[model samples]
Target: MGAHRTSLTAQLFRRMPVGRRPQTEGGLKRTIGLVQLVGFGVGATVGTGIFFVLTEAVPVAGPGVVVSFVIAAVTAGLTALCYAELAGSVPVSGSSYSYAYATLGEVVAMVVAACLLLEYGVSASAVAVGWSEYLNQLLDNLFGVRIPHALSYAPEADGVVNLPAMVLVALCAMLLIRGASESATVNTIMVGIKVGVLILFIAIAATGWNSDNLSDFAPFGVAGIQAASATIFFSYIGLDAVSTAGDEVKDPARTMPRAIILSLIIVSTLYVAVAVTAVAAQPWEDFEGQQAGLAQILEDVTGSTWPSTVLAAGAVISIFSITLVVMYGQTRILFTMGRDRMLPPIFARVNPRTLTPIPNTIIVAVVVAVIAGLVPLNWLLDTVSIGTLVAFMVVSLGVIILRRRAPDLERSFKVPLYPVLPLLSIAACLYVISGLALVTWIVFLIWVAVVLAFYFAYGFRRSTLRQDVDDEEVAP
Candidate 1:
């Protein structure tokens, strides 16, 4: 029994092979650079939550939501640095899951995979739901007809189903099935539209800024600020998406770190600007249960519908892209796990014509669509935040472990301040995670438990690497 257990431990701790060189012989094409890297980071980071999170956060923190944004940014920035180091070293597609697998062990990788699945699936669904709200707002503006509340929201929002959100997910899935690609150029255009609309909101909202709104800042005290910080943390979830491209990024040693820092600064600044301008334009108390909060603020400021219309239209387009990107991330993560035999082989199967993971994409789309149709947006957002915070902490720890375990490994990017930055990253993630509601934590724990149970029941016995090990021992 002791020998058996030892063998299992060795198998679990085996590191995945590092792919340090570009695969030029019929492999993935490397074509992105620093500018495109920053673009990707900014585009992924500035979606969905910013469009609707104030409705859920403002009542808790009042005007202090700006402070909340800063708190979340600090934590996310720290983790992005850690992510940069690991991503530059590993240069794999699974993001945190890949990092953990390389540094920790197979079981830990499975756990990280569960966390990532939560992050991507919930983030995509939350973004889709946000898109649904904006789509309704845009239709109202353009055609003077709106999707009825009954078909536009989940049960928590006192509606039958969020049909529009489900429809959005279904549409994105079809696009994925047809091998839709968001090239660097296309991503840049989407990023421009998103940033342009946000800038327009700030410019208009700044015009109506009043100093009185600042007076009641921190009305709910430190605890409230922390709670709101945890909620808004969802806004910064995609910053690591930048680091994931390290494999293809040019001069990754210098470019990866710079892009991560610059993009975080840009994203955080925009978020703070939006929060400050929003609170200044209207009392924070009025934000609760507000649909299309940003657009509504603009309408209230100018007493005209034109600015709101434009903002709504921009959100509709940009958030649709976000949904697609996050869903693609989800599918790819599952494909990696399936390839490892941690999941059924079907998830790893790709269509020869499209060269995409069709079954994996379908499964992800179905799950996200169901959640978008049934669950409330705020619930999905908080759940996503919790999972992402945990994953970020894991990645930070992985950086430290890899540094200690493989001191001779070639690393393009390394975290500065040695253990200090990675330690701070872990601490910051934990502190913010503490601010989440008990219910969110409970739900997260239950979800993770379910994934682990599935892994033990199926993954342990069927892992391809384990099978290969057994076959080798038995031969000759």
Candidate 2:
């Protein structure tokens, strides 16, 4: 009985060895350089919110939405430092999930994985919904036609299934099945398209800027800005997705920190610039009820349909890339879990030809596509924010734990202020979480509970580590 209890405890606390070269042995390919890594971070982080969230955020914070951008950036920056340290120290494929497993324990890893599943899956679905909006805008600008509302939006949103969102998810899954290298290459191109269009809008929109737009900033005060920060916080969700590629990243220690910090700076600067220009182009109140807000702002400023058309096209292209990369992050997390025997083995099976997790990608694609076709955007945004915040907090906690537990572990890069930075990250995440609605918190708790129930019933009992123990005993 004592021996049996010991085996159960071992299974619960098992950790994946840090710095395992799984990809070179039997898994994903290592082909991403610092450039591609940075592109992945920026491409995934910049797309969805900047394009469409203004409509929801601006009225809440007034012109102080720019302040909200800065607040979110600072909060995310603190968390990114913790992520960089873990990625350098652990250097595994599962991002925060893998980090928690190595530094904390198996049960913690499962919980983190649940958080990540929500973050990537719901974010992909939300981005797909945003893509549907921009695609509709582009078509209307180019050819004077639109997808019927019933076919273009979720049923709960007063329409039928969102066809474009599902189609976009399906196409992205096909690209992912081809391989990560191919996906990264395409992501680089999409990043260029995204940046170029934003530059064009800034150049054109600055010509008609109004000083009066700056006068009434923070009309709803600090509380409003904080509220908007909570809403816009999900915009930075993908920055840490860069760290998930530690196994595939080149010279990960140096590359991971550089990519994480660089992507944060790039994404934050662009978000703030876009927000300031948007309000300058039109009054804050006008942002409410606005569809395709950025493009519409451009059209209003330039008095030409062409600039709006260009913005919409850029949004459609970049949001597609964002959805693809985010869904890629989701598949890899599942693949890692499968390899650990916390999930079905098929999820870990790599396609020999493509060197990708084909089964995992297909499963993620189908689930997110169904969600994209059905779930309303507003609910998804908060769900994603809550999940991402919890995951970030876990990574920050893991950093503190590993530092005390294994201080000798070699890390390429370390958080500058050590415990101070990680503690601040935790505090900041909780503060932001406080600003979320009560209903959002309730729903998130229920989701976590459901995931925990599945783990105890299946993952804890059938874990790969437990199977290994049984096999060893039989062999002796």
Candidate 3:
């Protein structure tokens, strides 16, 4: 029993071969391009944080919320560098999970995969719930009769079922099932629409700007800024979603890093500008519990219904793309896990016609839809933040490990300052993580423990590396 346990531990730490090209050479299609890849990153990110998070974050940081946006942007920027390097070097699906498997070992990779689930699937559900909120807002603007609270909200939020959120998830699932390139093409157009709408908002909101709003900046101090930044980190979820498409992009080595960097520049610039413009337009104290956030803000500033109606309509259209891209990322991650035998083989099977993982997409959509229907949106956001932050830190660490272990390995892209930048990335992620609530940390710990337990009991015996080890031992 002792020997058996020791051998299992060894197998759990076994690493996949470094520098593995994307399995798309034979499996998933290599059809996605640089432009669509950026759309995936930006689409998954923008609609979630800017649309509704101000209501939650402004209350904590006051007008200092603008600074919080910068804080989160800096953290994400540093981590994005690390991600670009690894995504270029490894060029595989699963994002940070694949990076860890190639460098840190199987156990760490498994933990990262669990984190990816929270980052992709749970965030997808939460964003869909936000979509429902804006969908109601758009309906109220157009027809004056909105969905009833009982039908549109989770039970915890005083509704019996979040029907609209589930419905949105279903729609996105349908798009994903058709094909990867088809979904990416639609997302690219939605991304353009949302970006234009936000630019319109900045222009209009800037006209109403007041200097008084800057007076209360940083009212809650550095701790508050850090805490709000931690929450806002959830906004950057889409940036890494770009990395997860390693298996589907046209040229993984050149396109992966370019898409990640380009998306970061676009997202961070918009995020900071929006934050500054918004705080200048209204008192931070008025942000809490504000529904139809940007739409309501527009009405407050312009004293007209037309601009508010436009914002709501834009949100309704763009948030759909958010759900589609995130669900796409989740399915790809699960498909990679299935290929490695961490999940069932059904998830690994691609449709011959679509060249996409149909079972994986269907399963993700069902689970995310259920979560959207049952859980309050705010309850799940912190979980998403922690999971993505931890995965990012893992990628930063993996860069150092891979460089040391495979010194001569070809890397198309490299972190500019090497150890300094990766170390800063790790420190930035940790600083933000420090601000997470105690319950969030507890939930994260319990979730990781559960995943690790399953690995020892199930993944250990079924791991491909374990099979290889058994074959070596039995050979003459």
Kindly list the per-residue Cα lDDT of model 1 for residues 1-476, writing each as its tens digit: 12233376787666666553354442233566777777767776786558988899999999999999899989998898898787777876677877887788778888888888888899988888888888988999989999889999998889999999998899878876765343455666787899999999999999999989889999999999999999898877667666555445566666767777788888998998999999999988899988899999999999999999999988887887677767766876787678778999988787876656788889999999999998888778888898899899999999888888888888878888989999999999889899998999899999889998998899888877677767766666
- Output the lDDT of residue 230, model 2: 87
Q: In model 1, what is the error at residue 120, expressed in angstroms?
A: 0.7
lDDT per residue (tens digit) for residues 262-327 in model 3: 999999999988889998999888988888788888998999888988998888887898899999
User: In terms of TM-score, which candidate is strongest?
Assistant: 3
- Root-mean-square deviation (CA) per prediction: 2.6, 1.8, 1.9
Q: Candidates' lDDT values, in order?
A: 0.82, 0.87, 0.89
Whole-model alpha-carbon lDDT for candidate 2:
0.87
For model 1, where is the 10-residue window of minimal lDDT? 20-29
Worst 10 residues of 3 by lDDT: 1-10
Which parts of model 1 are misplaced by more than 4 Å?
A: 1-6, 20-37, 183-185, 243-259
What is the lDDT for 194 in model 1? 90
